[model samples]
Target: MKKVMFTGGGSAGHVTVNMALMPLFLNEGWSVEYVGSAQGIERELVGSLDEVNYFPISTGKLRRYLDIQNMKDPFKIAKGVYQAYRLIRKQKPQVLFSKGGFVSVPVVIGAWLNKVPVIIHESDITPGLANRISIPMASAVCTTFPETAEQISKDKTHYVGAVIRQELKQGNRDRGRNYCGFHKNKPVLLIMGGSLGARKINEAVRAALPALTENFQIVHLCGKGQLDPSIGVPGYKQYEYINEELPDVLAMSDMVISRAGSNSIFEFLSLQKPMLLIPLTKQQSRGDQILNARSFEKAGYCRVLEEDGLNDASLVSGVMEVYNKRDEFIGRMRNNKHSDALSAVFRLIKETAKHP
Candidate 1:
């Protein structure tokens, strides 16, 4: 049997993307294995799969500042690579598919060094640093945005759009409403700041809740970090995070307020949900979120907001504007029903297996 190793972690975003493609791999009779950091959210997410083998390695984020922590990066990379080499040897996978994050860096490198073919999926308008560095070693690169292709080594990328969970392959507005406790009279505003949560966006939403509730119900995914019952605003429900319930929350929404992380943005787009996106700006390494937000805004799929200009009033008005023109905004999303990336990725895998 063909053995396929998948690497990614840090958030459900990465895990969900890999899960989206599992059925196709199974149909092709590929033995699926996963490699990611032991501590990331993927550990729990991966536990549910049957007959799947897993390998854990140490991986850490690269901070932009020059600090003593930077000194540990090389050593971590070496240890992770060694751990990954051992894991890949045991699994003996013929191919490795990576969704870029710090967790996948060593896995990709180890796979390449072991002569295992590597395919990387980058889910952003600009490639993540891990994927960017792995481009030279990758046998193939897949992307959600065609624009990202230019940034990679030429001819290495296939624009497949972003992969999304199977649940969102089609949208159910009523199911979404029911899942979020929609009363049917008020619009539902869905807000998420990625898996870790965004303090700025959460604060702005909390500050604006009084006005937001006047016209809509709110289903907020506060990333566990912002789950403050004390900030409880009527007409709003806060959850630390919900892995299995996202489809229902998204389906019931009239519009969304979120960060511009590629996974969230694409999931919103796939569901045809209108949104106001706040791109992360504090760190230089976060440039991709800004670019991803701008790309979607330019496509007229969502309204993009910069954190610098954000406030309770501006956020409320932005939501109102999108709600007022909801039909037009959602029209862009409706036109994107066939934007699933997995179909194209599977095709690539099929061809690679034959050629290799």
Candidate 2:
């Protein structure tokens, strides 16, 4: 059997996208191994996955600030690269497929050093630094947005949309509504923060509870540890996290109010759900969220709202705008088609296996 290595961790956004490809890999009889930080959210999720080998490495996030933490990061990264090199050497996998994150960087470098063919998928319009560095070294760079292809080397690019699960592509709205207890006539608004809920978006939604409850029923995925009792809106249902139920919740909703995380953006598009996207602007380096929002906004499937732009009045107005033009949003979404990222990865593995 061919051995395949997948890397990326930190947020569920990266790992969830990786998980979407697992079934295809297994069906093809490929041996799959995951390389990621032991401390990432993936530890909990990937631990229970059957027939998949999980190898932990010592990856750390690179900080942009001038502090002791920044100084320590290089050491941490170097250690991770060493660990990854040893793991890749032992596994001798046929190919490496990376989803962009600090955790994936070391493994990508290791794969490059070992002469392993690497394919990376970047989910945002502005590629992450990890993806930027991996681009020249990678055999192929898969993208969710066609606009991002121009930013990378032309010869190495493929427009694969975002790798989404088969379940999402096949979810049903009628059954989803019954499961979520949403009213047939009233619109359902699904609010999400990547895997970790955004405090700002959660607080804003909580503050607007009274007004929102009157107009809609909400399925809010409050980040795992950040729930506030203030989110006790009458028509709102809260989840600490929703892995199996995500498609149902999303299917039931008419519109989504979410952070512009690439994973979430692609999930909405695959479901063809209209959205109001709030991109993070607090940090200087958070260019990916802004670009994800811009890509969908350009496609006419979503309206981009910045942090300052989303007060209670504007959130209400934005919801109304989506409600009024619901058909237009769906019409625009019809043009959206994500690639078979999992199948592409499987093909690459087979090709490498043949050569090996």
Candidate 3:
């Protein structure tokens, strides 16, 4: 039987594309295994699947800032590379598929050393630090954004578009409302701050909730350890994180306020949900979310609210503006075109493995 190894981790953004692709390979009678940090979010997401094998490796953050952790991270990364090299040699997978993140850098390099083919997927217009490092070692670089073609080698780039999980399309709006204990009397608004949670976004949303609940039923996925049990309101619900119920929650929401992660924004666009995007500032991130937000705004899919200007009042106003103009956004999304990314990428991986 053919075998394939997947590596990506740290945040859900890095792991989501792999999650979308894994079941395909499994159904074809191929052995699927994942390599990620022992305690990262990827482990939780992928390890829960019984069919796919999970392997843990030492990983260190590829930080942009100066810190004492930088001194020890190199040693950790070096150890990770060695461990990954051995794992690849033992598994003897035909190909490696990487959804680029810090954990993926070592796995890509390990694949190269063992003469295993590697394919990478980049979700943003510009590659992240980890993806940028892995691009040259890859056999193919699949992109979510068409504009990303200009940045990578013409020969290796494939504009396959965003890969959304198929389960998201199976959501029942009424089930979502029932789960949240909400009714159809008012429009529903959902607020999400990425995988790790955005402290600033959470604070602002809570401050504005009193005003927001008057007009809409609110469902807040406020990230782990960020929930507040002290307050209970008629039209509001809060969760630290959600697993199976995410599709349902998203299906019921009429509008959203969120951090502009590529995977998430694309999912929202596909669902035709009008959004008010509050992108992380350059200080918080590498500014990719800002670019993602701008592209969505340009296409009339969402509204952008930069983190520097985010506050209770501004959050309220942004929500109202999006709520008022929701139809325009919905119309644009309805008419938009998307590539069949899941099938395209799956085919590419199969062919790459065949040659290797």
Candidate 4:
């Protein structure tokens, strides 16, 4: 049987695209393997899959700032490269598919050293530190944004849009309403703060909940350990995190208030959910979320509310604006040219594996 290896982790965003693609390869009778940090959330997610063989590797977090951890990270990364190289030599996978995270850098290097073709997918407008390092070594670079393609060599770059899980598109609205204990009378608003939860967003939204609940029934995904049981309002529901129920919740939502993670924003776009995006400021992130929000805003798919501008008043106002202009946002998303990105990515994976 043919074989393929996937690598990416750290955050849920880094692994989501890989998760979406893994089943496709498995169904085609390919032996799928995953390389990620031992205790990352990826291990829990991918290891649970019956068909994927999960291999844990050493990886150091890549930070832009100067820190003492930076001193020891090089040694860790070097060890990761060596470990990955040994694994690849033994597995001899036809191709390596990398979803861009610090964990992926060593895997990409190992694949290059083994003469295995590597395909890397970038989900942001600007490449992350990991992808920037891996791009030159990759046989091809697949992008979620068209503008990102211009930054790289044209011969190796492909704009394949974003990969969305198929299960998300098949959500049942009635089931969603029932699960949330919501009635059909008021419009439902879903607020997401990415995987770990956005403390700023959670605080602001909770502060504004009284006003928000007056207009919309709210379902909040507050990230792990961020939930407050004190707010037991009739029209509001809170979850620390959700998995199987996510699609249903999203199906029932009339609009979304979220952070501007590219994978998430793209999923919102594919679902045609009107969004009010509150991007992470430069202090919190590399400003990738800000750029992701701006691009979506420019495309007429969502409204942007920068992290610095978020507060009780602005949070309420921004959500109201998105709810009011939802039709316009939906129209733009319906006309999006890159809706078929999942298929494009699948084709690229197949072609790369065949040629490799």
> What lDDT score belongs to each candidate, Candidate 1 first?
0.81, 0.81, 0.93, 0.91
lDDT of 2 at 226: 77
| Lowest lDDT block of 10, candidate 2 | 347-356
- Give a tens-digit lDDT track for model 2, residues 1-356: 67888998888878877788876788778899999888778876777678889999888776556777777788889998899888899899988989878899999999988888888888888788777877888988878778888888888888766677777766667877777776688888888876777788787777787888888888888888877765455678887777766677777788898888887787788788889998888484557788778877888989888887778878878877887888999998987655776677556556755674
Candidate 2 global Cα RMSD: 2.2
Best by TM-score: 3
The collision pairs in model 2 are 144-161, 197-223
Best by lDDT: 3
Ordered list by TM-score, greatest first = 3, 4, 1, 2
Which of candidates 2 and 3 reaches a greater lDDT?
A: 3
Query: lDDT of model 3 at residue 68?
Result: 100
Per-residue alpha-carbon lDDT of candidate 4 for residues 215-300, written as tens digits (9 for 90 to 100) = 99999999878999888788899998777788999999999999999999888988999999999889888888999999889989
Local lDDT at 318 for model 1: 91
What does the lDDT come to for candidate 3? 0.93
Lowest summed lDDT across 10 adjacent residues in model 4 is found at 336-345
Model 2, 286: alpha-carbon shift in Å? 3.7
lDDT tens per residue, model 1, 191-252: 88888787878888899988999999998888855788787566788887876667777777
